[model samples]
Target: MPHTENHATHREVELLETLRAQGGSARTSHLADVLSVSEETIRRTVKVLAKTGMVQRVHGGVYLSNTEALDPVGSRLKIRTKAKGQIAAVAASMIPSGSCVFLDVGSTTAHVATGLRSHRDLKVVTNGIHAAQALVDNNDNQVFLAGGALYHVEDGTFGPETIEFVERFNIDVAVISIDGFDCETGFLLSSAAEAALARAVTQRARRVLVVTDVTKFGQSAPLIACKPRDVTAVLIDKLPDRIFHQKLIEWEIEVVVVPDSKTGKTR
Candidate 1:
């Protein structure tokens, strides 16, 4: 469950769209006012985009880069941090006390790991180096990092040995995060190894929960992890438009649209 820039924030996405619309360049002040954030924050976000080759930062603002889309985890952590936090709180509620949970790698799942910081009597196993590290300190919660090949950029472990190692545990709930999921195609992801890891863990869990946000809807990826019908539940932020994805519920997959904790708004 390695994270990707696929979870980019609404502001970042809007900025990119605005840049594209403005013939590949825009003023930083204009963007800050449009996004209602400080100029410093906008500049910081631009610097990250510039470093990632997604944009070229000019004196006043940025221009779109010709480089291909790079969905790195770090960029994603900055994007949608709040929405993912809200989603995490809801997903964390599903795990009962003393449950054996399989936490996967992904920015959203990382939030879930953070949301669980106060919980006690939980056993956690994960392929994510970050997720494993986030859960290791609790006196009541035990953490295990499945051993295998380390994918540095994705911050995940994978391979046959890793899959075999994870299969040995009887997990109460498999908490997974994915990219590019659709009601028809189910779970699709950018990395084959991460998708393989997801499939392997879900195969052994008593229940499977796909924790994701609306950004994933209708996107495409090379690998299909699982179908909606196969998952036990899907925890998502309430998207403004869900009429087209109603079939997902018809598939018998429970859908939980989490509300923003601060605003108390589902949309």
Candidate 2:
């Protein structure tokens, strides 16, 4: 069939338009059975839509891209303050004194930077403007900011230049945050440019630790930052479902579940 101006297959266009009208959430298996195709085909279709920013993939399905706007950093800091703080504390405790560390941009990572303030003679390199600022305010640690174009939404710097700078140095440890995690795709972030920079940092680090809240599990973002196998450890508030947990363990990924102290509960 001749391709239409939309540049999508007829089924793809049909699915997108239907999702646009009825909302993007749909069951892959149900769509497959309804369309008389395999579930893998449905997943592929959704991935394409997600990459093009036409849809946002949720835990069990996809959602309209515009359903919820990306929260600002300040708002995000408030939303998951306790969980993020605990994750940051756990991440900080893992780092040895006077080591070189790479911190990625994100509210959670900013918390980690705050936790690292008391550590002496630490060399901190980061792409996050907020993390650099926090380190500077502490005035006790050495901080290097990767220079590049600032992504306002993410409040971080990223580009080829920044990635090149990160590639030059070998880091003892790297603490990263992601928007999502999946057994098949590994850690996921919202932007391709950010993911590229993150991958560079991950490559240079001897030990890579991913710090994220449990809510990140099961979500799929546009870019796959790094595979679980690329990292040495994962620290999250809690594990999600049993099947996903088992999958990570099967892959030999060390999972650390941090409990919420206030509630004294595991999320």
Candidate 3:
């Protein structure tokens, strides 16, 4: 049977997810058995994935190449879908139409772009391809994509040129996403290049909004994206712990918790 582009892509994503679950490397035979496909099929899927620099082939298995950076946006969109949707909705509510917004390359930010579709006019600046694609063709919105080296793994532009491109815009609100958070660190991201870009956007924007899920709490990342004082507000799916909550109060950062959709109450 011939594999259509969509079907092959779906199989590739499933294999990658399985690899992540198995600690970023898996035997070809094991992957074949788990995915209920032939070893030849697994090899073919991995061949396509490897060409994109997403995976590396070994003697009898494959390993993910970029473990340091955040997962690809496609894989991340599948994670915490409900939580991200709620956060995106709350984030959209904060920004009025015709606002100049800066959205970063985070998966949650992509969802926020979707939420902004109903607005009449929006000036959207972003490095994330996903966010730009979502908001490009709706309600007279203008999307400015930062130009620089494109990182295919994260599906966003980065480097010094990207930063310079964003600096040209006067951002009304900057919506960011974090990989981890803590009282001391404030917000965290896995990539240093991305962290620098986030810092630049935060400095340029009048209001800085960090959108993330509660799972990031207590986790740690190498680079601190921004301090708590730099943030205007945070939109999350659930409440943070006591100590973290207290710190947000001290920093005067507004905390907006999206209620659980099923229960209509914040957790």
Model 3 is weakest, by summed lDDT over 10 consecutive residues, at 1-10
TM-score of each: 0.71, 0.75, 0.75
What's the candidate order when arranged by decreasing TM-score?
2, 3, 1
Flag the better candidate by lDDT, 2 or 3: 3
lDDT of 1 by residue, 22-110 (tens): 55677999888877889998998787666644578888878776311134555566778888888888888888878899988788888
Error of 1 at 48 (Å): 32
Poorest 10 consecutive residues of model 1 by lDDT? 1-10
lDDT of 2 by residue, 1-267 (tens): 413222345566556545543444677766676677887887888888777555777765766564321555656667678888998988999998789999988789899998898887788999988788877745457888988898665687889989988887779999998877666667776656777888777877899998887777776555567766678888888886887788778878788888787776666
CA shift of 69, model 1, Å: 8.7
lDDT of 3 at 219: 62
Which parts of model 1 have CA positions greater than 4 angstroms off?
A: 1-70
lDDT of 3 by residue, 1-267 (tens): 212212124577678767866768999999999999999999999998787556799999998775644467888888888999989998999999999999998889999999999986899999999999998878999999999999876799999999999999999999999866767657876565788798888977999999987777766544568767679999988889988888888899999999888899987
Superposed by TM-score, candidate 3 places the C-alpha of residue 84 at a distance from the truth, in angstroms, of 0.6
lDDT of 3: 0.83
Number of the top lDDT candidate: 3
Residue 117 in model 1: shift from native, Å? 1.4
CA lDDT scores, all candidates in order: 0.74, 0.75, 0.83
